[model samples]
Target: MSVSSQHEGLCLRYPEPLGPQANVSYEAAVSMLMRAIQLAQHTPFVWGYIDKPQEGHIYLIFMTQQLPFPPDGIRYQDQEQKIIMPAGPGRELEVMEVKFGFVPNSSDTTAWRVRRRYRMHKGGHPQLVLIHYGRGQPMPIMPNLNQPVRNYPLRPINEPALFVMGEKIGQKVYPNQHSGPAERPGPPGMGMSFGGIGNQQAMLAQQNNNLEALERRSQRDRSGSMNARAPPPARIEDDDSADESDMMSTRTLALTRYKRNHELMNEVFMYAAFSRKKEFPPPKSPYSVFDIANVEARVAKMTAEIDELRSKAEARREARSNADGAVGDDPGDVSMEVSGTTEEVPT
Candidate 1:
């Protein structure tokens, strides 16, 4: 089947062979063009021909990345005219009229020779466009507009697997809500008075403390039991083979631990590098564990030092000002004495 036949539902009503001219409605033509462009998004390339018998032309619509300029004598507000059409429910498709062709020739197939003009309707309806082309011109060759294949980054071989037991690695698995302890009943007269609410809160706190203590005790007991049951160290054998086997086992264990630690260190370095480049916020320090007393003592010491320095600077300035004033007074005194001597000599 022909491409047009395959997309018959798209409302493209073009004849198979080229007659002198083929007649198609403006609405059907626009619908076919929009649909073809929409399908081209998923494919590498798509092109189709629409016959406008009324204008005596055949339009060659093809996907292209380059913006086409308008022919001479025709001016547009923008280099490419954009037309918005409804694609699907709650969706709009934007189509650009990149190129306009006026002159038609049989030799150059690459040049767009058909003028595609859009007309807006009076009422709220689908807009229509009139395409003009030469009557006997053959279909133009499809442009080489295939999109370049994208190159995506591959995961590193050393990167750990991201799946575990049908769950993503490092994904938090929260305990089921039903599996948690049942909600305790509020104290008698709870929510009626503040005292009742306080009592209930205190009771809950005590219960939580008791549970934590029990858990800690059980853990300690389990560790003690395990330690007590541990077998005594094996006696050294005189045989060389036994000693060699023991050494080999110890070396293997050490190597295994070193490898594990190396992997962990690599993960930490990678995270630190990424965090630095990304400028992630530093983790907040716990206020409960902060040494507020030590900070306050240091701050007090700094304040005292600052005050002492300020006092010393003030004293130095005061001394300098006093010395300046004394020097000025001496100069005035000497001048006055010289004037008195001159007056006496004249007498």
Candidate 2:
């Protein structure tokens, strides 16, 4: 994946090694990446990819979100590489469970209070957990094994990345069919059921009673299904020949909303230094409102403030240490002594 040269510094890299056991199938990775792209276009924030290196190492890189496509009189770096086709919508996706906690430190109370001004002394990092909800085995999210999830406020690209973490699921959508799994098989594959059928001894006595009870339960389920609103119609995955590699064919992944990075808006203000044919330099951030002149200077001022605070903290610590040391080294008796003679009272 290529990145925007101007927004290069916006991303962070984690070179932690992902073990081979955490391998995500190629198709699932592609689906997640595609969803990430969709999220970047829709949301006005910084985002990037959790990439897998050749050795299957997990390397995460983030960047400022860019507009879905280049504005008029502007061209993107991968202009020719992007493909656009009319498509229905993304599937419903799952939201993963995010647990936040504090990182314990050994510093004393005074020092901790001082340090907290600049950063989160305790609650900065979050523990990622699997969203299995007890369906099967419990899965913990490790840097190497777990893939990053891309969530959108409105809807997902096909479905949420949480459900299709490692590989894609569900049937393929068609142009003119309902897209939900209305008649899919049961949880443990088709033609399977738990509990045994009644034997002749009890079956004969409760024949009418059992039939009526089963009929009522089935009716209730059907009613509940009918009452629920349906999503956009999609074709079912009835094609047995379609494998992981063949999925998502005849689908176009494109941006749903038009974000305003507004490259063309500034062209009116700046001098006509270059022709329209020349590609404009990418913005440092996605939104034009945040592109301020003194952004760098403000960052430097914050850094200076942090340094000053650090120095003050060190001074306080040094003074406390010196006072303690002097008290310990003094030769005079530290205990209070009672006076032997009493002084005359003054009027």
Candidate 3:
């Protein structure tokens, strides 16, 4: 595999197997593996793995360096293996399981039985487990391996750095050593030096004197400005009183305007309701003689006149009804007397 510049000269060891007893979730295991890969980008070597040593559990072992086995005893046979690469950004890791008919001669039949049981558990489907290598490649078959193992170029997983103590995750921590004590910061307006304490003291005293002189000048300037800007007590009181009177006058004028507008609106409504023609007059200007108190007194007088008119109309209707009843009763009496006179004439 062609190594990138960042991974050049760095050899990664075989990743150690992780089992169920480790109490690590699948996501946490993947995170740990990715973190190790990130560290390997800057360091010489890193080791990581993802596997559970149980039936139906898949194995993903990562290694950059050559295997440490004897070349003659281990034969590398080519087998069909699928490679899963991230399609785009923000894609999760995907795993593919394939069936491997070729089993190693070194392993006992118990391993093959477990494999069969796992396949049976999966409903007799082919067991094909593919690792997330950068590119597609064939897996190397070896003796004494019950499962298929693949090797491909290493690519860093896109993820945030893991939280690890005493180490800067995703960054290199270089050892910075000093041959002597750290240089302390010198006083203001002074250069740092290792020698000549007497010279430093003299420079410090001079700086203090300059600062004191500047402070005294600033104080004198502030006092002079204050005295020049301050107004006389009597003048200040007069200005305050004038501002208060102006505010009061403005408030009173605004209130009078509001009351006049309100009265005008009330007059318009009353005229619209009670006028003979039911027509509203044109609006007048604000400066027109429209007194709120005069409008209120007129409204009261109109209300009293309406009440008196209603009472008089009711009394006249009552008196007309009584006069009509009296006239009808007299006609009935006259008809009775005429009938009596006719009866006496017949006798």
The global C-alpha lDDT for each of the candidates, from Candidate 1 onward, is 0.35, 0.28, 0.34
Cα shift from native, residue 295, model 1 (Å): 13
Best-to-worst ranking by TM-score: 3, 1, 2
lDDT of 2 at 198: 43
List TM-score per model, in order: 0.19, 0.15, 0.24
- Among these predicted structures, which one has the highest lDDT? 1
Name the candidate that leads on TM-score: 3
Candidate 3: list runs displaced more than 4 Å.
Answer: 1-47, 51-170, 174-295, 298-302, 333-341, 344-347
- Over the stretch 180-227, how does candidate 1's per-residue lDDT look in tens digits? 111122233321111112344454444344434433443454466457
Tens-digit lDDT string for candidate 3 (137-237): 23434345644333234344322221121122122122241101111222443211112224544534543454344334434544664576754233221
lDDT of 2 by residue, 1-347 (tens): 13342222212221112122133322232333333332222111112232111212222222112312111111111112212222224322222211211112211111111000011112211111111111112223233322222221212122111111111232332324321222222232111011123453332234334323433443554466556756335633332334322322221111101112244455655656544568768866656567466887899899999999999999999999999999988787445434965555444
- Count of backbone clashes for each model? 1, 12, 6
Task: Give the better candidate number (1 or 2) by TM-score.
Answer: 1
